[model samples]
Target: MLPVVNNLTLKNYSHLANSDEVSFDVVIPSLPGFGFSSPTPKNWTIDDTARVFNTLMQEVLGYDTYAVHGSDWGAFIGWSLYNSYPKSVRATHMALFPELPLQPEQLEAENITLSKEDAFSEQLWVDNSVGGSAYAVQQRTKPNTIGLALYDNPVGQLAWIAEKYISWSDPRRGTGPSVLNDHEILRVVSLYYLTQSFISAAYIYNQNPSSFAIPLSKAKTDAPFLFSNFKYDTFFIPEQIIRPLTNLVYYKSWDFGGHFCGLDNPPALVQGLREIKKYWHY
Candidate 1:
């Protein structure tokens, strides 16, 4: 993965590790302010994260070109990376579309009705102070306070992150049963707790520009992209939101899985990747 803003680690990528067909070396770096990575000198936004990731890929990793995959914040960074360095990204895929909205007409044409799930997501956007991120509300409005609380309390960190993971996953997709194994969820959760990366990961929300207003960064991405739709993610991107973006050749809708599809539905996740690979040479 590019850098994990969340508490997740390379070890959590066991799904990829066990795949015999995919022979890929993984590089899991902690984003600045997360894990072992040093904190940024000052507050950083998504753009800053993208710039730092670009440098990591080009100068630090000496990677001229590479394929990238992202979930949650990772997906945001991946899109930004592709936007910032199109030539450097061979191919990119994301499990969920961010909070970017579509034109009113587009939303209407799709007949996209906001279901109860969508309403929940909308509330998150509406309630957000600067824009739409519960984490951002906490971070931007009160960073030091929240950070200090979670700094040493391991339980606080787990609860904060676990809630996100649970909420981000689609509740309709049998979140409590069929979709993701509790052991699997706990594995990733434990990783976060052990690392004490909760506050740092949550800080990503605070640092990034609020989602109430979409950033101009969307225009920066021109590389091949995939938007894997899950039943219940933190935000719902009706097909209309995605239709306008050019260079998006692959769009797959999963009957199962949620925001964290890579973990909740690995088989489906792998299938999505395989389909993308059919066209994307990487």
Candidate 2:
């Protein structure tokens, strides 16, 4: 999901532009309690947001069906949308699928072998779980603590969000200078500071603590699924594991880009979505 400070239209993925055969009317909405949207009631989760968005497309916008694409939190909500309203959401595309890797014991029991890429991805996951994910833990358990701390301090907020933007992006773009300029970063930070919505945005982690939990059933959605694995992303799930989880129609791995594909490599991100259009059924 785009952060609270980031609106849906902020990133320009030019590859989503209309073509003779395909055209897209993108509807970019802020998550509840984020950006200009009102705060969610206590205990709201991704599922709740999905329901609201479904209504927006079906009832409000007067569409009988729709398709969805998401990264990060948006991916979680996309899963919920596909699961909860199978008939309404026709297809799904995602940059990040929040599924844990097979445990070492499970891999051993299955006699699974890892490729060079898979091994690297596995190591990154292990490293992040050990320390790189401290921010997630804090947001999950004590959102208000950090929220209150960074709420009014723009510098503090910048440092908090900017770090992720830098670390989670392609090394080429994230290092030395960022793909996003200081002005852009400031704009995002200012949105949270002026609106004081960072608190509720951070609360999403607390509300959905089970987000990281591995699915009990690997087969989660029957809807067609498309996934793009960017090299520098936090972790990359092997196709062997992903194949069982959904009707994975297309999967591609890039040598560049990272967690923030929309910013780091907008064309590639948009191209991935365009590829999904081939499998999308009305």
Candidate 3:
């Protein structure tokens, strides 16, 4: 599930009229080399994470099948579970598209016309590709260099994560100027710094070179794929382009929210995730 402010699983999913806890149990693992999780081999990637999570759900947790939800890299992980283990994953709801997102220039070259909304979405994708991918490259190419550089420097690490949170999130909010404020960004930075996971977390980009390039033919699955596209998230592959990627059973687009839709728009994220429950069989 996408991480909410304070692990609001039952609250967002909502429990019984009187009960405080949500009916179903919530399982949120710290991905390998993330948060409090242990270190991982240098070869570990999103697929590795997915396989491990599959085992966790089936072997350790003893769940026959479960609903899946994620955003950003979490989107890639969610898709991997559905693609690799269809029978084990009942359904998936994602806030971002997993495949290599289509570029505006690519669409233009193909003579494809997009609506105004789609146009803006593609533009944001292009802008992010230009300005926002530096951290990805830095982490992917030489994680240790930066990781150690900022290992003892909490302030530096804060800037690293805070920059993305500021630039990527939808600045529009009903209650505030930005979806994520100083406190929210600091929470993640503090976790990374205190846990001393700065370097380990960066290894994901290094390990997952094929995160976005996976071909649609290889992504087939029996379980339904539910997509929730938020405007500011920089993933805006059109529906026609997305339909061929998997068993895309459901798709919803929002005018607001950002990469962290759970934080940017909690209610919408909950609604999108809850949709998969209807498709669940076990």
Top candidate, metric TM-score: 3
Instruction: Candidate 3: give the clashing pairs.
Output: none
Local distance difference test, per candidate?
0.62, 0.77, 0.78
Measured against the true structure, the TM-scores of the candidates, in listed sequence, are: 0.74, 0.87, 0.89
Tens digit of per-residue lDDT, candidate 2, span 1-282: 232213233344464345323556678898887888888999999989999999999999998888888888998898888777888888888888866656656666867777776676666666766768889999999999999998888889889998887776676873332345456567778888888889989989999999878473554457788888877787667777777778889988876777777766666676677776687777
RMSD of 1: 5.9
As for model 2, its CA RMSD to the true structure in angstroms is 4.2
Q: After superposition, how far is residue 65 of candidate 1 from its true place, in Å?
A: 1.2
Higher-lDDT candidate among 1 and 2? 2
In model 1, the clashing pairs are: none
RMSD to true structure for each model, in Å: 5.9, 4.2, 3.2
Candidate 1 residue 231 Cα shift, in angstroms, is: 0.5
| Model 3 misplaced regions, further than 4 Å | 1-22, 109-111, 173-179
lDDT of 1 by residue, 1-282 (tens): 112212122344667566533434455567777766766655677668778877787799898877667776777777677667777876777776655654435556867766664555544433332342556566767777887887787677667667767766666543433445556566666766666666666667666756445743344556677777766554556555665664777877666666677666666666556554554554
Candidates ranked by lDDT:
3, 2, 1
Q: What is candidate 1's TM-score against the reference?
A: 0.74
**Clashes per model (N, Cα, C within 3 A):** 0, 2, 0
